[model samples]
Target chain A: MAFFRSHVLVCVDPECLARGAHDVIDALQDELVDQGLIDEIQVLETSRIGGCEDGPEMIVYPEGVHYVGFNADDVPFIVEEHFLKGRIVEKFREMPKVVVDEELGPLRPKEVRIVLKNCGYIDPTNIEDYLAVDGYQALGKALFEMTPEQVIEEVKNSGLRGRGGAGFPAGRKWDLTRQVNDFPKYMVCNADEGDPGAFMNRRVLEGDPHSVLEGMIIGAYAVGASYGYVYCRAEYPIAVETFNIAIAQAREFGFLGENILGTDFSFDLEVRVGAGAFVCGEETALIASIMGLRGEPSPRPPFPSVKGVWGKPTNNNNVETYSNVPQIILKGAPWYASMGTERSKGTKTFAVGGNVKKPGLIEVPMGITLREIIFDVAGGMHEGRHFKAVQTGGPMGGCLTEQHLDLPLDYEALTQAGSMMGSGGLVIMDETSCMVDIARFFMDFTQAESCGKCTPCRVGTRRLLELLQKICEGFGEDGDIEKLEELCEEITKNSLCGLGQGAPNPVVSTLKHFRHEYEAHIYEKRCPSKVCRPLIRFEITDPACTGCTVCARNCPVEAISGERRQLHHIDQETCIRCGICVQVCNFNAITVE
Target chain B: MTAPSTERDIPALVRAAIEKHGAKRDALIPILSEVNLALGYIPGEAFKEVRKQLHDPTEGVFVAESQLHALASFYDMLATKPRGEHVIKFCENAPCHVVGGKAVWDTLREKLSLKNGETTPDGKWTLVTTSCIGLCSVGPVVLVDEDLYGNVTPEQIGDILGRYE
Candidate 1:
């Protein structure tokens, strides 16, 4: 093997690639060759660095120096000044280099990472890279040292529950499968991470595919299963590709095929990609979809553990839940149990995004408060915007207000606060976000995603959406509030699956916290946040206006009229309330009413 | 999208797809996905071919063409009608919708001269609304074919779409 002085890791994640990180890689390589330092320095591309906002960023290893916001144009300077001359490039330096540590220094993790340990640290496509970081040690320990029942006992002691929204105990699920008398049992990894704001599963599958595979293998052993399937969404092309490579590599290493490591236990794994169905995230629906059906959820009487995929006894766990198993086996139950709260043990990974300062995949301890997650971990709201509310989970989750920020974020606490932990999607909203519109937004998602098998979810979601639509359009009647509440209660009580049961959460929670906003939309015919176009209007203040004609020129509907060095006015009759003038205006002259 | 190949021109191709993944009754979705990927859209003749290939008289298991068509229409990714040369899937979920997605949606409609699920008259582009593509932090996300564009602003709509054709 060849030894290199430094490793140049350029981020080529979707965010950075969109920002021209590929060009930067090419330019850096070309510059290194031009300077005759190509052989001396190794150039490589990696996944997301967690600093997605300052992407097209790279770090030089051994020195651990980070360079941010540099383009292809600055590559020659970087090669000459840093790689050749051996001097730090102060112009592009994002942060001071610290002594090398196991954790990510450049990204500066706000919380400990257990589920996301291998992500961004190892190359997902190469199994050897995963092996270097003690990849299969847990599986080895589980297979050789501990018996199948002992493995389940350790998990039960650790109190590790499912991270896939339902919060069921993972050990209990495995025990149920182990007790069931069946031949050719199965284990499944639910990589169908369909939550709109969550991509932690995508990151894990793309950055450390073997970790999930190793976790799945360990899980299969504990449950007495002979076969396993990893059902991933086809939307994540890179994740699927990486996982397939990991599976092939594992099989080659004698870790996946029949009689792994020459033991009596023989197991095999295959990949089943979903066809763009959100409801498939539900375990039963996912099983049905894997069986080549319409991906509809059947009511849970005999849970998936008792009778699952293909009408056989099966154990199904989400991507994050499976990713936690290996660490528990390797480190022991006490080490894993020492981190989190009383009931919810260990860390939970969340995909934090929206109007936050730092938006990326994060893993925090289970009991971390929403305030700490939003302000401390995510660096607070963007541009110092006032904290309005934060929406966790997905379409099924509810929006929490400022008063709920101090509440510890766990399955029980969030559910008690009128929201569920869901699949760990923390989307922060600023003052500009309207609660009524937010409810409408979630209603639209559930209404469309509802499979037609259940009438309550299918028809009730449509009716709730219609009521929300009427309210947002300034056509809400006097009795609309009572009617909405009645419908919300009825839907929550009568729905068949989790999709329908949780569909009313957004409206119910928003009404609990921000009913005044909804009242304004209904009675006063106004959007308090000025987000609903039909309820809001735009006008240019004369004092703030410089008569730049920027808004007038850029208006899609040509609704604004003004002259040079004069005031501008918006024709309400012609204005579609698209809010283009507000975005285009440089002088901050336009105000929403 | 694949090349504009008719059903009659690709019987061998259709038969090969069915042979590769049509052994089980549940292979209906994967078979449709493979055929759509190869022939752009699931043609009526291709459905008939899938039915014929899956019709195992000895096994007492036969897949109907109506079942294949129902599976095709149920999933958003599978389209019975051709979606032109390029397909654009815009995230219309709440996360994207709250973060100024409506403006970008309107701009796309105006620029492409088509609404959701409508293909252009020139057969150059098809616009559709998707629930979410899982990049919620950067709202107003657009996926053109396999490429994902995040935090898409209304002003960048024209330049982004121009790269397709």
Candidate 2:
């Protein structure tokens, strides 16, 4: 293989591609050959090197200089000056902007960004940007100044817990693996963020991959491990690509591999892509998937700390948990532990989505209530909608009603409120959302994702889903609600893994808060929110009908019949209850009952 | 569009994937992913080929074809049978459903005249419902082949599908 002194990464994002980036690349290559520097420099195609508005951009490294808004004509001068003569062409050079303005609006006052500190503030692909902002300082400190035990003690004092649903203490997990006398221990970073609405881990992995890597290296050093793996989901293609690039760059910089930073510590890691299995997010199942087996969770007695990955001891932590290690090491333990509540320390990043006006990612301290998160951070619900409930966590987590809005957003508090902080997927709902239908939606997700390992999760969840479906379809009997509660109890008690154990949480919590909604659906055969299709009907009122023929023309099932300028009628039997007429109506003529 | 591979190419494709990754048990998922990317689905003959070549002398592990099929069927990304020329995966999770994803989903289904996991008669398009691709901030997301369209409305489904075929 041939080696080059510098690699020039040209941005080929859609915007840049439309702006003649390809012609610029051809010109750069032709000019490099003319200068006899083709063998010395390498050209590579990369996506989104920031400043996409100033298209046709390229970044040259090891100098990490960026040149933007240049066409094919400017390539020769750039090559002649920068590549051959070793002088950066200042006329075309422009610093790369931190391109995260769209994802993260202006940082709010209530937000405390420890894990998200460098997310939008730096160029993710370039290590120099991370290095300038005290990137590997903690790794250097831990490797040279502190002992393995001292590193563990500092993390233990920081009071950090795993951010991946189950809030196990991070330092304790490290110490447990360290206590094991097994050889060749492994540290695994769980980036398999499988929650439906959550993108917190994806954002961190794509934006600041080095931070997670640096933290993993420090954790591996403290735990006496030499190898690590970052298990990222296949859905997040951008994150997996960014993390691979970060790993290659870290290995090239001598921060990874043998004798890192000129110390005796040697550590490295690789990315393991998950194949669309939500169960693989669990620790044991994730290990099994890494070993090329089916991703099914087994009973835990050998816990990963005792027996893991090829039957050797291993340590596993989520991406957010690992990303917190370097900061806890660089800043002292007290400084890191000063924020957040008593039990839960530091900040948590939430992917707040659905119904909320400013639906995006936010990182807030632990004691922040659900009200503050919804109203202050996410800018409350959308116009003309009243907040009904917020579904924190994901499919397995329960729904928090309006009564629980003031509850604090810690692990313990959320768990006490019958919902867990499952990877911080807060999907808000408005008054238009039907509680029974929402429960059915979550049940449908869990039933489909169930691995069918044990009987309760496999059969009981299906049965519960059937009951919920019956209620939604207006066929629920009087005893169906009681039957659902009993099945939920059995599934929660008898399931083997976390997937089965938490499968009934949505139904359990929804029934606890919205029992009246269930009663209305079963007894009166009416959907109060008019969300359940079988129980609701759409009709055109006689007086308000303009008879413009828009609804008749737009109907997919041809359910409406009317003249051009007269009253309209909808065939009740033929209407599919799609609600298209209501959306397309010029006047407020159609109503649902 | 690429031509479909015949049965004769299974061995060579499996061998190339194993050679590029490894013959170890841990290389199974990557090798399967590679083959799936090439052919859009894993043929039964390919599973037999993998079972023949994949072995670990140290661990004394040899995979069975049945296990390979089970794996292929378990993961949502991997397909056992052939799919259409283009696969369109729409988000069916609650985050999208609450934000008018049902209407877009209905529009897509009606436009293509296909249900979930069904392909067109001419094999032009296949519609599948995926859990989520992590773009909930812009709900009602659609993925056609490798291109992602977020914040999709019902009317835009025609334009999005038009760009595919």
Candidate 3:
């Protein structure tokens, strides 16, 4: 085997792949082979890099110098200057140091980065890369050094709650199954990250699959489970593929399969790819899907810990929750407990997205304020747009406004503020966003995903959607607000599972925080943000009109009129309200009011 | 539409899918997914064949046809009806909508002359709205078959759809 002094690790994650990183990689490899430098320098492709905004970025190892935003043309220069000559390419150093704030600076580390430590560093497909970083050592330690009881005790002491939104203590869940006395207890790693805006779990599975595997192995040992299944959604093909490879590699390394690491304990895992269904993220629904049945959540009391997959006791934990287990085991429980708040322990990974300047996956210690996450970690709202609200926790979650920005983010605090810490999907919204539309959007999602097992969820969600749709379409009645409030309460109280019970969160929270916007939509027949098509109209303001004819030319339905060098008029009669004219108007003449 | 002869031949295809999974009841979703991959949609004949295979008294575990159809109809990826060659899944969730998804959605519908969940008359494209594909950072996203197009604008919709055919 040939060894190289330096490695060129490129970013080929989803975002980077979308940005033509593959072509740049192809160019880099061709250049390297042409220069006869393949033996001297090893080229590797790592995952997300976290700094997705400055994509197609790569690092030349030994120096640890990162070059950002490079294309095919810049590769030959980097290879010649950095690899061939022993000098760093100064011109290609577009990304400021990891600490220093660059142009899109919030990608910097205000984060503790426990969960995301290996994400941007290692090649996910290669187990050797994972091993080099002390990957399976946690599982080895748990299997050999500590007793199963000791491992469970450590987890209990750590206060590591479930990151899958419910915030149930991981140790307590395992203990529940351990005491069940059921044979063949199963451990399922819920990689079905169904929360729309959240890709934190996806990144963990794609960038560091083995860490989750190691975590699952430790959980299996602690909970006395012999078989495990990873239920990953089929939409995330990359995550599914990477996890399968990790499973295969671990089996080969003797970390999985019978008598792992020369121990009496035996555990094996297989991947059960989920067909498209959002509700399958629920533990019961997930178990049903794994059983090749319709993914539907049954009532609780008899949780998965009591009777789960194939009628055996099962312990299901979120990917992030499981990923944290290995770290909690490797480092002592107290060490893990020391990072987070009094109640919610350790770090939380959030897929920070939407209108943020530098949106990407970030892991920060608990008790970090939302303001800090938005402004310090994510660089605030993009394009100087004023902050409206940040929607966390997907369909089951609510939106928090500027007033709640300084609130410490943890399970209890968020719940107290009327939102749950639901899988940590923080979607930053700017002033352009309409709270009514946002509420309706989440309603639409839950309504579609409702499994129809319960009347309240299946029927109530449709009614809530109807009310929301009525408000958005300028048909909101006098008693619409009261009707909505009553429906929200009824749905929350009567729903069978989390999907229905938490379905009204978007509406309730929007009513609490952005009530004035809702009132405007209902009473005045006006969308405060002008997002509702029926409530707003695009008009050419004469003072700002340059008569450029750009709006007229770009109108999808020929709604704008008037000749070049003359004030144009928007023909509302013909307009489809597609917003193409507003987008194409160069003179700042178009206004939606 | 499949010919009557082709409909008769579905049992062989269904048997191949059943044989792949050893006719286990727990492998029903995988079988349906495999059959959906082989045939464009899980036809009524395919489900009947799967039901027959599942009830094989020797090796197969019993699974009712009602249960199979219920499982099949529940999943968004599985379709009972015939679909177009290319499936265009547009993200219609809040994050995508917040970042100009409505304009792109409008353009797509107008250009294709089809509403959401409607396939083109020529059977070239099936437009459907998905909740999220977990790439919300680059919002207003759409997936044509396997290829994902992110940060999609109304103008880019034409070029993106153009590449599909």
RMSD of each: 7.2, 8.9, 7.6
DockQ of model 3, rounded to 2 decimals? 0.60
**Fraction of native Cα-Cα interface contacts (under 8 Å, chains A and B) also present in model 2:** 0.75
DockQ per candidate, 2 decimals? 0.55, 0.65, 0.60
Off by over 4 Å in 3: A1-107, B1-9, B58-60
> Which ranking of candidates, highest lDDT first?
2, 3, 1
**Quick one: best DockQ, which candidate?**
2
Model 1's C-alpha root-mean-square deviation from the true structure amounts to: 7.2
lDDT tens digits by residue: candidate 2, B60-149: 767888888878988888888789999999999988999999889988898899999999999999899986888888888999988888
Report the candidate with higher lDDT, 1 versus 2.
2
Off by over 4 Å in 2: A1-102, B1-8, B56-61
Per-residue CA lDDT of candidate 2, range A442-525, in tens?
888889988888899999889988999999999998899899999999999999999999989999998999899999999999
lDDT of 1 by residue, A502-590 (tens): 99999999999998988999889999988888998888897999998998998878888889888888988998877778888899999
How good is the docking of model 2, by CAPRI class? Answer: medium
Error of 1 at A309 (Å): 1.6
How does model 2 fare in lDDT?
A: 0.90
Q: Between 2 and 3, whose TM-score is larger?
A: 2
Tell me the deviation in Å of residue A52 in model 3: 26
